[model samples]
Target: MFPWGDSDSELIEVQGPRAAIAKPKSFHAHGVHFWEIGSDKRLAGAILHHCRSGIGKLRACTGGDQLALFKIGITHDYDSRFDLYRSHGWEKMLVLFYSSDLGQVEMLAPAKHVAAIAAAFAKTSSDGALSAIARCPQNDAERAMQKALCKFDLTLDAPVTYVNVGEQCLVPCLKPTDYVRTLNERGYLHRLIGCPIDSSAGALSEFWARLSKAEPQLEVCQDLADGLVDPRTLIPVYIHGDGGRTYKHDELMIFQFQPCMGHGTMHSRPVKPNSIGVSLKGHSFTTRFLFGVLQKAIYSNDPSTFERFLEHMALDLQSLYHVGVKHERTGVVFKFCVIGVKGDLPFLAKAGNMNRTFLHIRKRPFLPHSPEDPPSFFKLDVLHLYHLGVGRDFGASSLVYLMTLYEAESIPKAIEKLNSDFKSFLLSSKKVVHFKQITKDLLGYISSKAYPVGHWNKAMDTPVVVQFAEWLVEKFGGESTPDLLIRSGCKAIGVCMRTMLSSALWLDRSEAKIVGDAALHFAQCYGKLVHYFSRKVSACTIWCQNYIFGTISH
Candidate 1:
């Protein structure tokens, strides 16, 4: 008997809510619209094919010529070897046909691809593959399977069909629609998981819950609040420690899981691992507390808040130092340390380490003092070093030529002159001027054809070299002093001028030698200054040896 009834009209209004809604109409508004798009023809063919053969392909005509070739269908031929297996045999495959252009058409394979069809019937009693395929496409595939079973009396001996073990009768444990509705209402289903419910929910839920609970809580120190410290202060002290602090008594025992199969033994043994012992000393609680606060501030995502927190922490440490001094004990010292990778050391040394307040602490006692030596207490963080040192240096260097031209004595004055000059230049001319307009103009002039390249290339042009040397001396004041070299603006200008002169082939051997000697003298003086500052700051603080890690063990 024909499962879709004897006549075409009866098939169109087949018994079932889906068929009732999906069925075509002849005299309705939506019917008229569907008719205009030839949905009647496609629907009729789909119904007829599905009723007779239990499988059908339906192609909608509403998406223009581009979508005319697109189709949705079911095929038993997808797994031809299914009959050879004892498990669910002759599995049906849902296929979606798509075409980029009229000439090329291809099927949208299952999410698991060919493997899903190949593994349709597992060797074990459980038909996992068939269950997986059924669960994959909740709407289309499930509806098509129901139609197939009703029309052709098809039997799928899948895991979902088994009510209990040894039962041959087909029965679903839970309807897919009911299960999906239940999961959605329970808040377990969402777009992020990409399905109504995850297959491994039973195993993963407990672990996920534990992980959430185990997550660490981060809190900021109330003592290190804003309005406590001066942002412009030369030294920012964010840590404090006493020289006599210790952490050796607090030993941690660790264990590892070992496999049973091992040489000379039937059972695995718990072996003691090699370890590096660290001793903690000096204001451990204070250092840890401040570090925690700093960490929280850094991760807060508010720069203004972070800056305020940093300033307050610095002032708090400074206050602590004063308190220690009043008690005749070791005071908290403001030793600024900036650590970074080798490439970053140069810029960091020039930026943070160049300050007159702090000194670079040497790693090895035998090693000669060098400008590249990093700060004493703090290890260099790449983010902080890049943003504060290298990044800021680039911006500062861009204004060096303009600052030199204006001959500003300080950074603030140079910035003021730059802004004013830029504004005036913009008001008078159509050309836009930036903060580093003078530097760009100087670079352009030097690179231009009118610039004397020959004079720079020759060794006899002592006048050009002398002219640059005199300019440097005048701007820096005392060319031989490290204090002069340590000034960021002077260093920037010297580096910029040296680069331009070298690039122009203007720096002869004698001129290069003079610049080189002056740079060396600056380095020597800078190293001495760093050491001197270190000694001076050590008097206020405990001056305990610090580890790069949070622990400061004596």
Candidate 2:
């Protein structure tokens, strides 16, 4: 609840642990005066705002990584200039600090916690003498602003010295082998530690130059490290160590090396019952990250939750990769759903059942607030797989499913009818429900006998994908204009109708009823797709489970 830093005027009273040691009231690198707080109440409000926006983590990435990298050896005097520390590192350090425009810091760690960090920073100070100042640009427009602003007789660039935050000589190894060696380098790999540097702290570029010098053998470090500390580095930094509080303004302690390719298997040897440690249910970093994401999604309604849900779903799927129930033929009938007809039935049943379960779990009254929808590409692929199963012969199954719903004793006649209907649907079919387009498409397929093959037309045969693209344009293209939405919707409907023609290619005389049943089932599954977007339920896991079970249970 106290203000941060020191100031001569009574107007800026900071009543916190580091209140005495904070830099004097002055403009931070971004040209904002942050040295004052009207009262403790204002600071409290700032804390609350931070919690809501999750800006603490967000800024940690910016100020912690970006800024730390920028001010490697830079030292501050007037709170804005850093010449003393800069002089120590052979002019390698440069510093700049920018207050976020998004909002105030939202993290309100306990005062004791914050105090610890402030206290640590305060201890690293030299004599209370102002060092030579450094000039900075006002904005991007004028490159000469820094030189002009130095009228206070500040230097543009000066000598700097690096702070040694502990270093270990690393005789790096090669790829997979080097990976293991790197882990041994930390001795206690489980409890390793490293210093954090903010890449955007205006000192990143300079700090990067110095860190590079520390590892001359890793010439790649000299080359690639520069890329790592560039102002544009947005990669998340997960450090490890004790004393997170002391690094509040600059550093943090987090997990060390993250295993990439064969990571799960690598840890398999270390933990007993490896499934518990590395599988979906365990205490692995991903699992922990997932839980955090879920907490945010459920409690804070963060949009990022959707992304996390899919990731968790993927892990669940990976866990099920080789699992199966033994049987002589196709074996055990795992309780899953049975929808659609023939080849289409299996996929539709699985997809529908999976989506339904997700919806059931998320039983809540809420309007659609997200901009994303379930992936249509996957759905179309499933549909394509169904088509391939019926057969490739354009004379029979293929034409009916690929073109329109008409009876053609011959292939040539069916092809002509399908082409005519396609042209018509593309031009007309406006203001129709998606299902209506499917019906029209089926009719056209029955009329045509020729089935489409090859990639180009095969792509067009996917009505749902085409409709999804059109729908996306309507919802997000430019400024969601009414006219554009209507036009986009019309095109979407047309594509759906044209694509429905594919169902005909799969129908035969005896299979007519089967096809009818399949159509009904396809409709039911398609309804699930629509419902998923409105409800925001994830279907991938459900799909995987049902695929394994053979019976899709919702």
Candidate 3:
């Protein structure tokens, strides 16, 4: 991808992630060569590295919003400069944020560029022989840095901005109402406002149909998707929260708003989402942006220090639900409830502070929400529950069964041979497998608490096992040898998995019904195979069927 502007300009070819280690290449920035900026190449090189990252990390409170600190100043021997600060007793220096071009920072083109540089780079040091052209002493350089920051009136001090709680690591943000105001003022809502909203369930697309059926108190987006009522600017909203980390306990949670409406997933779309709030409880800050989407607002939340983030977030959501916020300038009434939430089970439970097993029928968490009769939210995550859980179980267990046919002296020997074939098959198909070796432990074959299921920790390697199973059946299937039922089951389930994950946007009733019946053929075959091995098969849970029928029926 090209930079934001001027694609014709000279560009640096940075190494892609596939490389073992990328060799740094010299480059220029803002019309100045980085290597030529200073005399000491070591210090100059450090600046280049830190420009991509941070130098020293500290905290600052700007307008009562706690933020990651950046000290822009001229310095020599950058290491010693930070050491003095540490000796004087400050929060332990973590990562670094330093820049020598303090006074000259204002010369940057856009005000936004100024803020972005300060967020990432902006270092300080007492002694540097040569630095950003005309480098000065520490104290004077810091004053220049502070002056530049103040001149822009950034740091979320603008009236429309909010405190940062590491909220999406936004370089700059706007308050929630201001965010809506900006969008509305810019005419992003032009087509949406006062537009005819489809409330009829039959006329609705899958997105709205499923939503309306799930709650059914009122039509799906009427509370947010309408502007027909005079003097109102309704903004339909979908709040999505996510875990910061995967394959382990999440470090923190992130919430963003993706303004969505219209018929189906593909019939229409909205601008990308932005951050509204974040939780940063003394953990080191994270700088990863979500798909490079610009975040609008930050509500600093740390469970210990900034404990009221969630409370404030709920209050803000409630305000949106109740009287709809008025645009500061336009005075348009923008009303929208969080008509829907899109997130995985873990993130949903954590954000709502509900029981981990949310589908177990418990007291409702919100004011107007009551437990569904069969939990409409049980829509199967085809990737996880199927590809990662049950499908993976069948795949690995089937592989283990194939291993037994090898008649190796030990289970380990059987496993080794099976994995060799598995790896070769996946490699031939140009798929990468993360696991070094597959073992009985990973398949949970030794466990009595549950059936022989795949309990692999890394969720990413799921596809390899899945493809391997399908390949094994394809390569070894015969009515006289391999179980014909199991072989068919593999092919059927693979087809169903691919169908469920299809990118197709719209579907007719017959097509939906066919896809709904698709998984059943394999599930039936799988059950028979399970019974053949275990002598009994547990009934498929109602929720899975409910999801299949409810969604298809929708």
TM-score of predicted structure 2: 0.17
* lDDT-superior candidate, 2 or 3: 3
Worst 10 residues of 3 by lDDT: 275-284
Candidate maximizing lDDT: 3
Tens digit per residue, CA lDDT, model 1, 1-554? 11122332222321221232345443222211111111232222233333323222122213434443322333333233222331543222222221223222122222333233434543333654444444433223444444544554343221221122122322223222232233334442221121112222322233223322432120111111232322111111222211111133332111111111111111212211211011111232211221111222221343333333323323323332232111112222211111111222322332243323223222211111234433422334322322332223323322343355566786457656656655554465444322233333332223212211111112212222223323434544653333343343345434433432333112346656666665455334334433444454454123211211124321
Top candidate on TM-score is: 3
Instruction: Locate the minimum summed-lDDT window of 10 residues in model 1.
Output: 253-262
Superposed model 3: Cα runs more than 4 Å off: 1-215, 219-238, 241-311, 318-336, 347-380, 447-450, 456-460, 478-482, 503-506, 536-554
What is the alpha-carbon RMSD of candidate 3 to the true structure? Answer: 16.5
Q: What are the models' TM-scores?
A: 0.16, 0.17, 0.48
